[model samples]
Target: MLLYHTIALAAGYLLDLLIGDPRWLYHPVCLIGNLITLLEKGIRKIFPKTEKGELFGGFLEVILVCLISLGVPCAVLSTLYRYMPLAGLVLETFWCYQLLATKSLKDESMKVYDRLKNGTIEEARYAVSMIVGRDTSELTEEGVTKAAVETVAENSSDGVIAPMLYMALGGAPLMFLYKGINTMDSMLGYKNDRYLYFGRCAAKLDDLANYIPARISGWLMVAAAFLTGMDGKNAVKIYKRDRRNHASPNSAQTEAAVAGALRVQLAGNAYYFGKLYEKPTIGDKLREVEPEDIRRANRLLYGASVLSVLLCLGGRLLVQFLV
Candidate 1:
């Protein structure tokens, strides 16, 4: 079983690299998002619009979402494996491919780069807005580039390494469970008026889920910098120096490493939902971020992802051998 899962993980990573999330297929995350929305609406109807009610509703939401996410896949995979083990492996590999976003992340960031390289500032902003949470309507070229680069750096952990870690540890069901928590966070985990109380559980859960994976991603990225001939020493230095720069404990880990690797500053003030947010800068201003940095960041992300796969598979295999 352990060997089967290890092979499934590698196969899934290769599948994601070859073909990213296709529009035609039904993605599990989309289903999970819909379930969250429906449950949120139903919970709101059942509970009063008060702090205590919201808290209870939020907890219920987490419980229901996690159960469905973990349970459905486990049931299906178990039945399938009982009937046909090979078919089960194939289905599980497909699920793993669906959960990862490595190729999609790279492609989207490059789209922003393409727009900026062609001098289409509006198009660049539009492309970047698809990936980042910040408002990009009034950003400069450098701002757009920085946003794309920063997103690539940060999501290298969230979208790729984190999921891979979960999948390696517990296979497909657990990976989907992590995705469920992440999707909930993305949808409702905000400090804004609407979600301040309603989304608190989801937000805290996401932070807790990502805590270790984020730090591991930071170090993996630093090692990737070293392997890729970037400034690995500076990557480690900046990562330690600025790892705590973000309000979210995990967001700045890879951002700091990538910034130091490239010797460019990232994460100053940025507007979100039409309001300017004052954020501390990460990395030194040794060089200004340019359009090319987007591609460079993608390279770093890909390198880190590859390294993560090796380590996860290697570690799992070693443990299996020892056992």
Candidate 2:
């Protein structure tokens, strides 16, 4: 049983490594993603559009899912894989970690850097738009670069690292359940009239799940920067000063750290659907962000992410010894 799990995981990772996130007909992740889209529609159907109603419903969704979808399934998987259970778990963990897109995140961010360095602000904005939720138009060179750097740092955990973290502890079903929760939070976890009530739980739950891992990823990124010969002290200094600059308690913490470490300013004014959102600055100073920053950030992300895996595996192994 464990052998199949190990082989399937390796195969899935190879598929991702070779083919990337193509919309292939047979990809398990894509198929799961599609099914999740349908599940979202069902979740949305149960709640009315009222703020009060949505809030209650959203809260219910988080509570119920935690107890059932994510919590219960993971518990079951852990029990089933019990033998030299720890070793079996190591295989699942590695597989799930591979599904995350840290490498791709770096690659995508670097594309923005490359275009911007070529003196194409317009192209850079267009490219950056894919990775971030903020409006890219009207962004200055500094703004665009900072946004890229910040997102690269933040998503290194949120988009790539967290999923793998969960999978190592759980397995496919629980991993998928986490993905569902994440996808729902991304799409519907808003606080305006439309999603205020309905999206409440998803947003909060996502925040809850991310708190520990995000900070962990931040620390790892700093170490990665140092190991790779970037400015380690600057990263630590900025992280200390700017990690809490954003409205989001967790996101700003890691992103601000990354900004400070890199010795660049991140965050400011961003346009979203024509509305200007004034955001706090994460780094101390503003410098002309170059393409190399993007490259450096990517390298840092990979180093940190891989290190995270090693640490997790080591921790699990320690647990085995204690048991």
Candidate 3:
């Protein structure tokens, strides 16, 4: 069974590297997101508009989403594995492929890079808006570039490494659970008035889910920086010094490493939902960020992703040996 899982994981990683999430295919995350939206609305109506009520509702949402996210995949894989092991392997491989966002992350960030290289400032802003959660209306060229770079950096953990780790530990089912937690946080984990209470549970769960994987991503990024001919020593320095610079515990881990590797300032303050968020900058501002930094960030992302695969497989092998 473990051998089959190994084959599935390797095949899935290759599939993701070759072709990322296509726009035409209906993604599982879409279903997860819709479920969250529906449940949020229902919870708002059923639960009273109070702190405790919202908290309980949020907790309920967390439980329900995670269960369904994990359960459905488990059921499908179990039934298939029982009757047709090869078919089960194929489905699990595809599910693992869908869960990873390496090429897709690079593709989306490159959209901003391409626009910045050949289009108007407004066009560049619009390109970046598709990838980041921050406002884009007033971002300067450098701001836009940094935002794109930061998205690649932060998501190196969330969109790639964390999911990869989860999938390796428990295959597609557990990864779905991680994605459920992540999707909930992405949707509801805001510090705004509307979600400050209602989204607290989801946000905290995401923080916990990403905790180890985020640290592993930070170190892997540092290693990748060296391998990719970036400033690796600085990557380590900045990672250690500023890994906790963000409001979210996991977000800054890889961002600090990338910032140091690139020697550019990132994460200084940004606007979200028509409001300002005062955030401390990560890394030293040794140079101005350029459009080229986006490419460099993607290179680092790919490097870290490869390292994550090796590490996960190595761990699995060691565990099998011990068992």
Per-candidate TM equals 0.98, 0.81, 0.98
Q: Give one digit per residue, the lDDT tens place, for model 2 in 206-299.
A: 8887888778888887888788887788889888777777777678766765676677777777778888888888776646676677777777
Q: How far out, in Å, is residue 206 in model 2? A: 0.7
**What's the CA error at residue 1 for candidate 1, in Å?**
2.0
> What is the C-alpha local distance difference test score of each model?
0.94, 0.69, 0.94
lDDT of 1 at 92: 92
What's the lDDT of the predicted structure labeled candidate 2? 0.69
Q: Which regions of candidate 3 deviate over 4 angstroms?
A: none
Cα lDDT of model 3 by residue, 178-235, tens digit: 9999999999998777899999999999999999999999999999999999999999
lDDT of 1 at 273: 86
| Over 4 Å off, model 1 | none
lDDT of 1 by residue, 129-244 (tens): 99999999999999999999999999999899999999999889899999999999999999987789889999999999999999999999999999988999999999999999
Question: Which of the two, 1 or 2, has more TM-score?
Answer: 1
The TM-score between candidate 2 and the true structure equals 0.81
